[model samples]
Target: MTLFEQSGTWRPVDRAAQQVQTLSFEMPEGVTAFRVGLEFDRSGGGVLDLGCDGPHGWVGWSGGERSSVVISEEWSTPGYLPTAVSAAEWHVVVGLHEVPAAGVDYRVVVSRATAADVAAERRAQPAAPPVPERPPGRDLPAVDGMRWLAADFHAHTLHSDGALSIDELAALAVSRGLDVLAVTDHNTTSHHAHLAQVGERYGITLVPGQEVTTDRGHANAFGDIGFVDFRRPGRQWQRDVAERGGILSVNHPLGGDSCWRMELDQPTAVAEIWHSSWHALPVLRNWGGPLAWWLSWGKDTVPIGGSDFHREGSDALPGSPTTWVLCEGQDVLGGVAAGRTAVGVDPQGPVLLRVGDELMALGADGALLSTFEEGRRRIVGDRVVLPAAAGPWWLEDDHRCVLALCL
Candidate 1:
């Protein structure tokens, strides 16, 4: 069944000069194409610029009103089709000329066009069918024990900037036995439906989120269940995420010259310390020089890592040194909210993770332990200690570098 609906407008609000609107949505799996519609009267006019965020670069142009801008049509952006966007948060910038004329009305619509075969198949299915049973031998241990509970929050796909498809990403997540996967596309949540579809088929939790990126830097928002317009800016959007019960993360705050300096000034749950595929971004040279200084000052902020893979030739890889978050139990959303997430070389690899005083350790076989007491590491034991005090504990692993946190 299709998990997305096409055609919608921005929340009714006043427009002003140099104004920005950010829209957030769950670009579920199975969506192949999408269209965005903007409707606003041309008044109080100067020039209106229209642009939308994409995987690698931004699209559309900020120019006059009354004309429609096709976001993904023909060679809109080089090497990328103006169709089939990855699932994640998306933002559209409607640069108003001279403040919208009083009482002017404008709305934006995003639509997806599916091939006849997929449409026919979709018509044949009732509501999402009962998930197919898993093949034998696939019955594995709890994902938390296998260190599959943690995963990278930032990544891309062929839908936009990344090279892989939604199905491929899910396969990787499932093969890794990830309990939760956050599909963060560049600027649009078009791929979310596909993530959710494949995730359910594979028995995993696919959280909806977006990478609110700008020419300056990028940020990610997880746990969102509805359409969030990242196109609208200000604390209201941040507040909207909180109101919707989502986790907000500032991505790769230390990346480069274009990196956003404001993440340091705002309050957020986590930050991306390691974003792989940096070599592909020649435009932003010296991306790592200032990261160390920023990290030193923001040690208190949670650290999450990702491959930041977009497609091939893009500045991210499928699993090149990604991150993971270890949740003690289900409720993936809760884990992210509690800062029980981790991003390192490989979250699924056998390793231990220590965040501040809190720690979590994973065994080569995927067993997990939480502790803070400095003592001999325990392995293959039946008895596990629960925290007696009110604070985070250590996550340990004998093999990999303390992979992630257990909050």
Candidate 2:
């Protein structure tokens, strides 16, 4: 049965009034399940984000990825959390992400779900794919009991705008030979509940993360810390994450529309200086842009890399430009917090790492090593070690294209 329905035209004036608008409805008694559907003029060149809030608090948000969501006591949509139905006031929140000058018409419908409907929806869910055979692990060396792990600090699943589910994404990461993957869906922690179970099944570590997204900038809050509110300022994100025993990293500071433009009193400890987008151009040119930004922002900021993998063909695959973290065990976040990270073109690509009191250059024969203190030195062999100096070092090919980076 139809519970509530609303239709209206959203103009630029409406968006100017408020980016996010909420409509509320009182739930009738004895309704065990509900579904919310949002429809808008697709060809009108407008973007609308959908989410829900129960009397308790935030339930879920799918940005502009999903148009409809179902919730009940037994199951919920991939991006939503399941909650028991009760007679109370609930809200549908709409974000006017992009509104055309001419305005766009939209409609939102909330309906009651019967048991048969819920059962059929559950039956239609996809099954997990067969696990793929992962490649052999690298034999990179480290100090005493520490080891270097291959990781990618940014990725997504269907919990947000990503194409794959949590299980499918984990399988893909394992197949690409990544030891760790951070699932950073935009503005939501709905995926965190399944990370551990899926990671164990795929034999990979999945770090809990949420991309605190806004029109001005985006940052990744790493750890199992609860949701970092996206509606807050960027500085508050840093403080909130830190106070909760987590770390925050500025993501893709130079990314076109998604760049870091928000003002902050201080910069985060880590920055994604090497992103998969750099692979599209001459490596040195792309690397230099972010390097200059980082130098100006904060020279001491630790550098990291991410593919920002969302779908198969959209972004580079996970582990393309792998992040190598040196840690005692499966503590990728700990390694990142300690500034023990390096980036390579891929899982098996040339790499420069700081081992003990020296530098280790693997698979980087004939490349030039650029460092902060020691200007430049030519690497003669694939496995070459030299006396360490002030770092933020990288290996560049004769064409001036960067092959690897170390922090």
Candidate 3:
């Protein structure tokens, strides 16, 4: 009963660094145990620390047959863990106690395995390579009643999985003319250092974030920097995220053959409507699939899009659909929370959303359709046009609110 599913590399450091890096992600439910596999260039490597970060403090650590100082754990080339996780994001940290100065690169793999699967070496392989990155460009042209923009909530770099660095991603976002950008790595905030600096330097709002991981699935809880231990109970993780005022979102909702299910149904903050992984499927299957319809009409969740690029080696490209945020500024964090956003499918071109005193349409053909005005309603062709309500109004596409729209 693992809560989610995952398959991919988790290394987050370069080869030249003196210290090896540790990676963690939220754990899936019904994961009775776990396994570890390490590949190093040197034989006499330093000690690598492996364990889980509990809410109170350190709960589990490598020891005895379970503790090997070399490049891997001692339990089984791939360590075995028997723990029923709680309903929170748990932390899985891998520390290299004493790393050797190996000029060559190295990698350590950690994954969940059922007791039976371990007995049969039944571990799922990670997902395929990341798609191209989004090209950079400008603010969307402003319309009388609506404003159009582009955004990407999920992005990575050489610091994590993206092929580019923090500067490059920020530059690309700026060049692509996107208004919002969120950098989410596997399980670390290592990219924040450069991302923050470049974001401010380049006038791009880089959302400080981490891809809170689980053995079962992954969530992109955006906003400030917070921690969720993948090794602890799952409930605690969710509480911590909500308690801190962060918006929790389901990443790649239809991934891993639907192995990744939200721990809590009907998520509040974000549910990835457009992602690179979703591109492999057909277009109709992309949004019209049973799962898409379920997440859309059933939950009415906010739609977000991301490249999910690891930045391993190649360039970054927007795989398919893209998220368009109609934020106030280039501030990724501020605008995203404000709900000025929309998502458009690839080949469908761009979409413009407005929450103004009057409902006006500035079509690509330069034709204006005055559907409704302040405090008035009208019927235009095949559509029933309602005036902009005096109270709170929501632009369904970008997740933004106009004056009176209720949250």
> CA lDDT, every prediction?
0.50, 0.87, 0.48
Q: Among these predicted structures, which one has the highest TM-score? A: 2
* C-alpha positional error of residue 6 in candidate 2 after TM-score superposition, expressed in Å: 1.8
Q: Please count the clashing residue pairs in each candidate, in the order shown.
A: 79, 0, 58
Give candidate 2's whole-model lDDT. Answer: 0.87
* Candidate 1 minimal-lDDT segment of 10 residues: 72-81
Per-residue lDDT of candidate 1, residues 1-407 (tens digit): 42222333222243432346555446555555554445665543433345566554444332332243333332222112244466666655554434433444555555554455334533442243344343232121344353335466666654444545666666555555455567776555555556666776768676676776554456787765443444556354567777887767777666665365553336575666556633334543233332443345454556566667655554544444445554665566665565555543453344444434434344434443443344534445332333234323333344323333323
lDDT of 2 by residue, 1-407 (tens): 89999999999999998888898999999999999999999797999999888887778889999898888878888777777888999999898999999998999999999888788877876678888999999889966789999999999998889999889999999999999999999888889999999999999999999888887888989999987878778878888998999989989888888899888768888888788888765543435776677678776677788899999977899998899999889988899998889899899999899886789999999999985554678999989999876567888877667789886
Alpha-carbon RMSD to native, per candidate: 12.4, 1.8, 15.0
lDDT of prediction 3: 0.48
